[model samples]
Target: MSFTVAIVGRPNVGKSTLFNRLVGKKLALVDDTPGVTRDRRPGDAKLVDLRFRIIDTAGLEEAGPDTLEGRMRAQTEAAIDEADLSLFVVDAKTGLTPLDKTLGEMLRRRGKPVVLVANKSEARGSDSGFYDAYTLGLGEPVPISAEHGQGMIDLRDAIVEALGPEKAFDEDEDDEAETDVDVSAGSFAGEGDSDEDFEPAYDDTKPLRVAIVGRPNAGKSTLINRFLGEDRLLTGPEAGITRDSISVEWDWRGRTIKMFDTAGMRRKARVQEKLEKLSVADALRAIRFAETVVIVFDATIPFEKQDLQIVDLVLREGRAAVLAFNKWDLVEDPQAFLTDLREKTERLLPQARGIRAVPISGQTGYGLDKLMQNIIDTDMVWNKRISTARLNRWLESSQIQHPPPAVSGRRIRLKYMTQVKARPPAFMISCTRSDALPESYVRYLINGLRADFQMPGVPIRIHFKSAENPYEHKRKKR
Candidate 1:
């Protein structure tokens, strides 16, 4: 396992900025607002010859255990406990505050190796704050500008020294071996490149990207924490406690999965706050980037208009989805509720008919295995591809069973069909007078395809392309 490093500091100390710099990606949200990060997030980071698991944690604060700030501090402490080292960041421009001293004392009590990081040291007058950080007794502070990528070499040397010589040597050896594996895995260049060459690298070894999204106060964070078997994410009775979409790596049944716990999304009219708007946008981005999305719903209030809208959005985005009903333990009548929910799922969301709906309790861990199995099943179906011959055969039988409607005394002829892509399977069909095809006729073909292919609960796209005539181009040339 890679060595772990946790970036811990008080609010607005540029910890997230340094995390982004090390990970070489903008995975964490950075803002001027204090206490923006409520959960600790992990990322694979590389610094020169060093490699480790970098954790960006919520700012440390003192509050009652039941309060929100207290919960945030709990998450930060959890990260520090799991990490091999702590990067105690302090804002050089602002100088050391009382809270910084308290945090320093707390880290010293924990007896963990910590590298004092003096952030925002780019200004000329920030040297005084850098000198002040020495009083914390954590060793000489490494003055670096996290945003501007200055003084990284000194930080790298400090980390290597803290990790000790033996560990650093082993890591270098691992990196050398990993470099060979990456080169072999990425060697796809050839003279004639095809779709096979451009296909995304998806295998059992790679983590399955799953995004959990739902309405506010729907227990999204609770469900994720249950899956993780820890209080890895902050959870509370308050609505919208989760403001940023945070991703966590998990191992489920020996399969790697990257689970994303997103902010509870509300309707546009209800989302008036700018922070909420940013949170919703981040959630949408997670959905777009995810391979599968689990739309959680409160069992008592399932199938609301907003819930249906979110499902439709997922379908439009061409993502595999499974409907998860949380808080099932609270239900008084499970039999009747399940029956009604299945009926409504089929009736109301006919666009994605036969979608899998699993009743689970995020708080009690009821039916979680079934939910995960169904999600895996849905992902498999979403990635399924039908052969061209099989597609044409199905098309022939479907057309013979129920031919296209006649338009202007001429029937629309669908001559050929082929699948264009998978991952929410899309197809293209060559047809005569494509524009004359009615929406009902298109729906008929879609339903036929779904039934024949056994593709349930996954979105399918069909595009009609007009058949080209050879004589038309000749006449145009003349």
Candidate 2:
């Protein structure tokens, strides 16, 4: 069995850099900024002959007991404990600090084997600096350049030694734990892709899987009641009601749509009650499963941090996002209120630039039609398809405007770009130097695609394959 190795370090110390390097892909979001990664992410690790499952954790920090950051710390610590060997990483250039010492002591106390990693050690800034790392009491430190792929052979030998020679690893283990979400990508390329074949055969052909989600007492049940013209879910003035996600099917303009009525989620602090937590989890599951999420924020009090977190989670999951400002009847200035909502959505979530926001009073039935129309429109955007010819044309413009800069004098050639999947669209790029591609340039292409194709709010994914066009190999030239 392939043992697990976890890369742990303080923020921006290049733990994710090592992770992406080992994985031979930029699966982890590497940024100059710290605290960009709020969650512990996992991926495959490969170093020459060595292979294992690797986890990238949030930059460790000691927070007060039971706080959110503290909880995150606990989660990372748990991962460290679960690992067979821990790659305790630190910024080699910055040298060891008190936090590094503290982190080392804490890790050693766990009684697991740890390999000290002094990252960013590509250049010999100070030859004597390597001597200081041994003082942490983890024995010899493996100086590595996670960014430059230096000292990897030494690192791999260390791992095989740590894991021992006798352990037979099954290569098929990762295939069993596969995470690629199997979604259909129907005939389309470049700009837009459709999920044509993989979708289930619904009874009446449900076009949109709409989910209504919001904070407690945001009138989600009431709004759903308005749609059904009958009491569907139990409604109450209490903070957390509607324990389960309830699906309601309805026809709008001869189009079939299934709306999932989810429980009102409260602040994580107030969610200690077992029942409320379960309800929140259920709602989240529905959000992942649904085609479009209608964020139901109360017009009386809009855009809570928890609400924003939910929206962020949806975006991260690559699901389509549509905001439904419920209880609009309560707002004092209707037109001014909408203007603020638009500004807030646009400014706060700029990556989702130009997404649609539908205003409605779930109780008054004031704007349900518009909300439904927005759902259909957003779904169309989610299932968008772009042809190969148009995609390359767009790619050419991207290269000309803000071309990829050379890394180590290697001018990266972005050979081709094409959309292979949808719901939300996924693009695969054939590039010579995928490793050197800057995050800024990647974001540029994403933003440009969204703006040019009118797929602003939909989740757009880009995958880089080093080899010549993978799809081209399968085609038989007549």
Candidate 3:
């Protein structure tokens, strides 16, 4: 029984700060720049005993439909529609402006429950703004400092009251029950169980961690907002507005997914600013931790050198990847563009030869289903493991077809092979004079293993081990 609360306000009013506080994590990019948030980002938040979904939205602005601010406004409106309540934040230091008044009237017209918040109340001069909030006609405003954790008790009481006392009690009871069950399960496990037989209880229903990464302004945030059906992240004409990796949990077609909206990655040489370097490091961290990465590209200028580099990094990191061509609606000839793109992908990214490339319009919500499906499929491949017997059979067949080249007039004798691990599929091969194996022969075996095992677009690792000779012990004694 999760309810949603949308935090709406003009730019730089501490909406993201409050969101991070409620969620107990810094999951949104908080900056002093006005209108930094463009998408509506959602997170599971708890205020004291009250639990609900919280959304951080773009700032409200007065602009026409054709303008970027107008589009941001539309996204905020959509969030308000989806939310059960709206936390209308105002700058207590600056008092109520015309924009706040306008937003108050807009929320009033919607006739939904709104909790008017006077943020930055910790400052000495905030009393005036706090008093001014009473004039909004949406009931008394709760004055609190979102940055310093002030006035949270009042805010929590307001939320509990708005949601009704009965619902609050029910949530408490559910939490207690869940805690009791967890304790009971822990006590049930015995210490005598063998490591192989003692399977740790884990929920297979946990959310899949997916990271969206690409060059700056590649529509990564837009794609996530579309999936959520709200303006959940800050998007605008400005590039690099998102400075942190923001993660939001979502359910898609009954599958739980934890989506990471990361800052756009730029080449190291061009990243001169300290902030930009930190942002790139954060994005790299997200990519390394992610189970699957969707590398986004602007369709108008798809597959720049940087984009290819990003894809190569994903492969090198051994993470599953899917290529996404965004803003497909603007493409004039879709079929031709896709054909050319596919050819280029195969030629440039041979490591991930059969990687799925989806053409999508994040704004229009086209091809999203295919993109998600591809992610699931790629994850499956990434976790694939082959049996040892099957691997040895494949190895034998491969050696018969193209035998390892002779080294210094002596034939290199290949022995058996076995799969050492999964999750990118690592293998080990024992052979006589393993150092004599040519790089070309190693590649031949790798290609053969990939083809035989149907492992496309996932990195495979092979390690060569020298088989110990039985006569070596006698020679050592001599």
TM-score of each: 0.91, 0.56, 0.76
Q: Which ten residues in a row have the lowest lDDT in candidate 3?
A: 176-185
Give lDDT tens digits, candidate 2, residues 101-152.
9999998898878888888887667345577888999978888898889999
What lDDT would candidate 2 get against the real structure? 0.76
Q: Candidate 1, overall lDDT?
A: 0.87
Index of the highest-lDDT prediction: 1
Return the candidate ranking by TM-score, descending: 1, 3, 2
Candidate 3 segments exceeding 4 Å error: 167-212, 216-264, 271-286, 298-301, 324-343, 358-376, 399-416, 430-441, 463-478
Task: Estimate, for each residue in 385-416, the C-alpha lDDT of model 1 and write its tens digit.
Answer: 66677788889989899998898899888998
Single out the weakest 10-residue window by summed lDDT for candidate 2. 180-189
Q: Write the per-residue lDDT of candidate 3 for residues 358-436, one digit (tens) a residue.
A: 9998999999999998898887777665656677777788878888888899988778776655556677899989988
- How accurate locally is residue 198 in candidate 2, as Cα lDDT from 0 to 100? 30
Candidate 2 stretches greater than 4 Å from native: 1-206, 468-478
